[model samples]
Target: MINENVSIALVHYPAMDKEGKLIVTSFTTMDLHDIARPARAYEVRSFYIVQPIDAQRLVIKRQIDYWLSEEGRAANPTRYEIVQLVRLKYTLEEVVEDIERERGKKPILVGTDARKYHKTIGYAELKREIEDREREFLIVFGTGYGLPPDLMRTFEYILEPVYGAGDWNHLSVRNAVAIILDRLFSKNRC
Candidate 1:
């Protein structure tokens, strides 16, 4: 399973504000649902929501618990299935550790941002690498403005920005995840 070796992390902490200062952004209910839906649809191994704040983490946990409960499942079984793939974590390091523990090796960290880096792997090349399944891959997305430059530099591959016909490149992390997942995992690609 190509996608089984792939995972995603939505980092709320270590994110940049519009001014580019590092900050911990709050997670929204929409992010959980939107990202998890595509992740489950793509058969991603797991969806990680990384937040350092305890209160925020608690709120997210409650939502996850409710969606996975019998009543919640009865209300929306499809949502329950998507919520099952979500894993809450305090930091990105924990996400990596979790994957390392599960796979017995570290996953190749693939970062996504609106800005282009000096060296970025194209979607086609990454898709081929993912198809080969030589190792696990975890594509990381950031909330707020974006991930900090120092953090972005640490990733093994920062995927090329998803461009549009216009010059504006800003995209919601949820939308970015959906687009990147489609580009990498969709069977029918142009």
Candidate 2:
């Protein structure tokens, strides 16, 4: 079980801006310390190229190993268990395969009105259901433009599309995460 003291984290290779430049030399702590020195906005932002799978695997291995360390293990044993870990690599479609294989049931994928369904799924009700039926629930998502059509069809419900900011979508995943974390902490009276 996870402790109240620790939290889960995920890292991604954020796509580069329209500019061809990937890496900037100004991410050093000293650089941020001297913001008055006048640096381009991009200079403060570090960038990475599309990483290779082997490189990604190496990164995951190193990360999991670090998590398995004494302090880390206490933080999240399930995430970094020394015992067998059921990690399977597959494209978005394989989410169905893995769910059926392990749970003998397919996951409910939702699309369309993402916001409406997200809110409709009462968090408290979900908690009660999970408490009674099972403690674990798996949610999978598609990346890179549109979601997989086959998987989208399998969703039990479609979420309403959300509109925010301006004509174009402006919110980043980090922003969404911060908002969610804030809600969680608020709920826990933290």
Candidate 3:
């Protein structure tokens, strides 16, 4: 079984650039639509969009509010429901505080990256841990080239990278979010 207490955080800043320099990344409209829909479908407790910049945070809030408003709901009821699951926070710390407030304790911070750095727990182990321990988790997805090593070091656990037969490992943050959520929460698990 999977845990319904799990949540997600899509980070926008302190990501890596092509040259591996730490930088702030902009959010795409597709990212807002794609990630939130799955988060709701998976029955996640909450979906957080963490942006350090005020303008970018406003953009995310507007998108979430618009999709959750009456007009947007009338246009697309399903998407509206999904957008309601989203929250826009200015920093990861804010997200932590929110989860603590909502769940009465801090969640386990699980970081996700496309590359393997430190020893990462396999998806199966993560799923088992969630089911057996019954603890809330805040799984973070990094944008741009991926989260900086320093940020990765802050996490208690880093999930294994999603890969296929080929050596190539590039995947959009939105797609990665959906894939990871499905693997962690899918009902067909043994």
User: Candidate 1: which stretches are off by over 4 Å?
Assistant: none
Q: What is the TM-score of each candidate against the true structure?
A: 0.98, 0.41, 0.94
Which residue runs does candidate 3 get wrong by more than 4 Å? none
Candidate 1 vs candidate 2, TM-score winner:
1
Output the number of the lDDT-best candidate.
1
lDDT of 1 by residue, 55-149 (tens): 99999999999999999999999999999999999989999999999998899999999999976999999989988888999999999999999
Question: Clash pairs of candidate 2?
Answer: 109-155, 112-159, 113-159, 113-160, 114-159, 114-160
- Point out the worst 10-residue segment of candidate 3 by lDDT: 1-10
Models sorted by lDDT, best on top? 1, 3, 2
Q: Tens digit of lDDT per residue, candidate 2, span 3-91? A: 11111111122212335223211122221112211111111111111222455546544554566577767786643442123232323
The C-alpha local distance difference test score for the whole of candidate 2 amounts to 0.33
Q: List the residue pairs that clash in candidate 3.
A: none
TM-score winner, 1 or 3: 1
**lDDT scores of the candidates, listed in order:** 0.93, 0.33, 0.87
For 61-163, candidate 3 gives per-residue lDDT tens digits of 8888888889999999998888877888888999999998988879999999988867698998998888775678899999999999999999999999989
